[model samples]
Target: MERMALGTEGIAVSRMCLGAMALGGVQDKETSYAILDRFVELGGNFIDTANCYMFWLPDGTGDESEHLLGSWLADRGGREDLVLATKVGRRPSFPGGGLEASEPLTSERIAASLEESLERLGTDYIDLYWSHRDDRGTELEDTVAGFDAAVKAGKARIVGASNHVAWRVERARQVAAATGAAAYTAMQNRYSYLQPRPGVRLPEGGHVHVEPGDIDYVGNTAGTALLAYSSLLSGAYTNPGKPLPEHYRHPGTDARLEVLDAVAAETGASRNQVVLAWLCGHESPIIPLVGVSSLAQLNEAADGLELRLESEQWQRLTEAA
Candidate 1:
């Protein structure tokens, strides 16, 4: 796999980041280990997970993904070779299916959450740490300062934000600068080649989808890495069995699909590969966070690393929708 700068932190990682949201809980331990081994075998090192992953499972247990990675790292004994990333702040599901209280961005909460995450991952320091979502109730200054403290204390090398608005990102950076704290250098949001309809809300709460304006903002801003989740639209771009999401059911979706088909046919690539290639070759520093259940799917995603689209072809894909 090819490498890309994670942000302005002077760190680099594979362009494709494997998301382990389903590891351990939704996916069996044996299968998860196989996936991890295969990913590293293919020269992939960027892995994304969260402390609250798979809490919505029937048992409402969380931390399975991170715990699994911890064991894998222990057995592999090359933790320094990989870029480990995990997030916090979302409310995990409790044992009877109710949501537990979320950890806000207060200093105490951030510090405690980092301790728990480090313990679960079996690592002294994280490569990338994310605030899973914006805690609007808490002051942004406190959040920035807390993350800076993590870096200063050798708990995390760099910090990022997921599910945050562009203005909030800018404001947080500003606060960090003013307070001499570490600012968020990367952002993760719901993004794809196809877009949701105007005024259409997919996640409806703290999880916001990336809009065109967000794309423009990130591209114009320097020193920000944009990592896209849901980059394949949950396989709707490739699998016939998976329908396009409801929020993405816009009038232009058919046109986008047609363009994707044309691009794939022209490049002799799969539709999914073409979508990923588009993300990789975008003007901004964008990375695709892909989640896979099977080794075949993982290989298909990896194939995109070698596929390069022409400028005109990229423009066509961009203008399709």
Candidate 2:
């Protein structure tokens, strides 16, 4: 796997980050372990999870993924070699409370949540700690200070923002600069090869799609990289049974799909691989967060990273619409 500098903090991460959202939830323990092991074998080190993962599922306590990763670390015994990332601020405050009732990014809550996540992951410090979503209700200074305290206390190495718009992210960074606190060095949002029509609301709660401003911001700014989630759109690119969402079903979608098929055929790769390759080689550059259910899927993603598209081919794909 290729490595890249994550932020100005000197932390290095893999080009492809493993999204462990479904591990040990929809996937069994043995299967999750196998997938994780294979990912490491392929030289991947970055893994992302959150405290509220899979909470919407029946009987989920929202701790399955972290708990499973903790067990894996205990058994595998390599805490220092990997870049572990998990999030907070999105978990409900009490049982039966849905996402709307999530905890605020107060100093007290941030402190408490970090302790719980540390316990669940069996780690002394997290490589990357994310503010799962922007808490507009909380004072931005308070949120920045909370994360700065974590870094100063040696609990988290770096901090990031997820599911936030570009302007808000810039505002938070300004606050951090003024307050002399830690600033967010990474941005994670919903991104993929096919884009939904502009201003169309996504079906998933708390999903913020990446916009052109986001691309320009990350491209122009130093020490910041965009980590894209839902990079493959839940297998819609390759699975016939899974159709594109209504928001993405426009004429542009048809044109992009036609070009996508042509590129995949030319490369002799699966549609999923082509999509992943496109993301990795984009002009602004993106670190794709991929979730896998099996080793086959993991291998295909790994192979996609090695694919280098010709300049014309990449341009054609980019200008398809």
Query: CA shift at 188, candidate 1, in angstroms?
Result: 0.4
lDDT of 2: 0.91
Question: TM-score for all predictions?
Answer: 0.95, 0.98
What lDDT tens digits, residue by residue, belong to model 1 across residues 1-321? Answer: 898777677778988999998888778888888998999889899999988877767765677888988988888885877999988788442354433366677877788888988998899999899999988888888888889999999899899999998888889989988888888888899888888888776654456788666677778877778889988877887788998768788779889889989999999999999999999987888889999988999999999878999999999999996
Q: Which residue pairs clash in candidate 2?
A: none
Q: For each candidate, what is the lDDT?
A: 0.85, 0.91
> Poorest 10 consecutive residues of model 1 by lDDT?
91-100
Candidate 1 deviant stretches above 4 angstroms: 93-100, 203-205
